[model samples]
Target chain A: MVIAAIAIARIHDLFAVVMLTGIFSLLGAAAYVVMDAVDVAFTEAAVGAGASTVLMLGTLALTTSKERPAPAKNVISALIVVVFTGVVLIYGTLDMPIYGDPMAPIHHHVADHYLGKSSAEVGLPNVVTSVLASYRSYDTLGETFVIFTAAAGVLAILGQSRLPRRHHDQEDSEKGMVSSPEKSKGAST
Target chain B: MEQFPGLIPYWVIMVLMMMGLYIVIAHGNLIKKIVGLNVFQVSVFLLYITMAKVEGGTAPILAEGIKLYSNPLPHVLILTAIVVGVATTALGLALVVRIHNAYGTIEDEEIDKLEDQT
Candidate 1:
């Protein structure tokens, strides 16, 4: 994953970068699987690697592929900010519980109750699903609405009439609505 | 040295997080920034999943004989976050397409220059 991330940072071609990001997400999903989070791995693979790559490629088709080199001054400032943030995060980690420690506060607080009671209460095999869809269904509902709002926002911005016809062609292709077969035949003939 | 083994994963996550932050801060391309943001979000997902892991536990699916299971709370929360993250990515990309259509360039510096001129 680290190697993929380094490649993504160094590579300038947007297509290559997009492909690398997909690989990176897949690697993360694999890591999740190793950590016993199969559900997370599934969602990560489907959303992070699948949908995100397609969306980014569509954006790339509508825009340029090469990134303009950032100004030298900006690079230095960015490096400084990143270093500071990293230091703070590392400091924060010093007090965190070790990996897979069963006695960790997070595991004891609410997770234990869910793990104990969810199968009986929710009558589901998958505890994660039970918690998400039944125990905390309100949060899930809000998240669904959030996704709805985001889709609405995208339509508002890039709807057919909002974009010019040339770019609208790209959007149409995105929706799998290409020119009719007769139009294609006429153009070819 | 005693604490080193347990803390190693956190250090790696920190490095990955910083790399994403650098890309977002240093890169000028709008799409690249979005990619960086996704990378950053993935690291956070890893962080949460890592915490939820039990040394020898299986997944949270109930079974007849299985006694140990990884924490389900983080998995549930991250599942919602993953969906939201993708939605945000889609919206951001849509906005990027509009920016390109309006400005003819998605590079940050060029957009600034165009805005200054206008």
Candidate 2:
């Protein structure tokens, strides 16, 4: 996963970067499985590896596949800031309870309630489902509403059912294949 | 053994998060920034799951004779978050496509230059 991320940073080809992002997502999903979160692993694999890659590929078809070389100055400064923040965050994690310690506070209150009472209360084999569908059903409803709003927002933004207009015609054509207005207009007409 | 409880996972996650931050800050490309944002998000999700872990625990499913289970709350929450993240990513990509349509360029510096000339 780390290797994929590093490669993504080094590679300027947008297509390869998108593929690497999928790889990264897949690796994260695998890591979730190792950590015993099957549900998250499944969702991450489906959404992260599947849906996101396709959407990004569609976006890549519209946009330039080759990223312009970044100017040199900002990168160094950004690296310094990022390194500093990274150190601080690592230090902060020192205080967190060790991994998988059942005695840790996170396992006590709310999680305790869900895991202990979920089966009896919700009568479900999957405690995660019970919590999501029964115990915290209202939150799930609100999240469903949030997804609806996001869909609405995406439609509002891209609802015209049109491919992106080639705005850079006067400058340079990155893809060369996606010609000017006439070709993009083909879909709508 | 001792290392699992040590800083290894946190270190890795932190480094990943910082890399995401660096990409967002240093790269001028809008799409790459969004990708970086996902890297950052996944790392944070991993952090939550890490905290939610219980030694010798199985996935958060009920089964006969299975006494220990990893915390379900974070998994449930992250499930929702992943869905929401997908929505937001779609929205963001949609907006990015629009920005490309409007500005003719997705590079931050070029867009700035164009705006300045106008």
Query: Which prediction has the highest TM-score against the true structure?
Result: 1
Q: DockQ of each candidate's interface versus the true one?
A: 0.59, 0.54
TM-score of chain A of 1: 0.85
Tell me the docking grade of candidate 2.
medium
lDDT of candidate 2? Answer: 0.79
For model 2, report DockQ: 0.54
Judge candidate 2 at residue A11 and give its lDDT: 78
Give a tens-digit lDDT track for model 1, residues B7-90.
889989999999999999999999999999999999999999999998889999999999999999999999999988988888
How close is every model to the real structure, measured as TM-score?
Answer: 0.91, 0.89
What local lDDT score does residue B30 receive in model 1, on the 0 to 100 scale? 92
lDDT of 1: 0.84
C-alpha RMSD of each candidate structure in angstroms: 5.9, 5.2
lDDT of 1 by residue, A10-108 (tens): 888999999999999999999999999999999889878987887787777667788767678888999999999999999899888888888889898
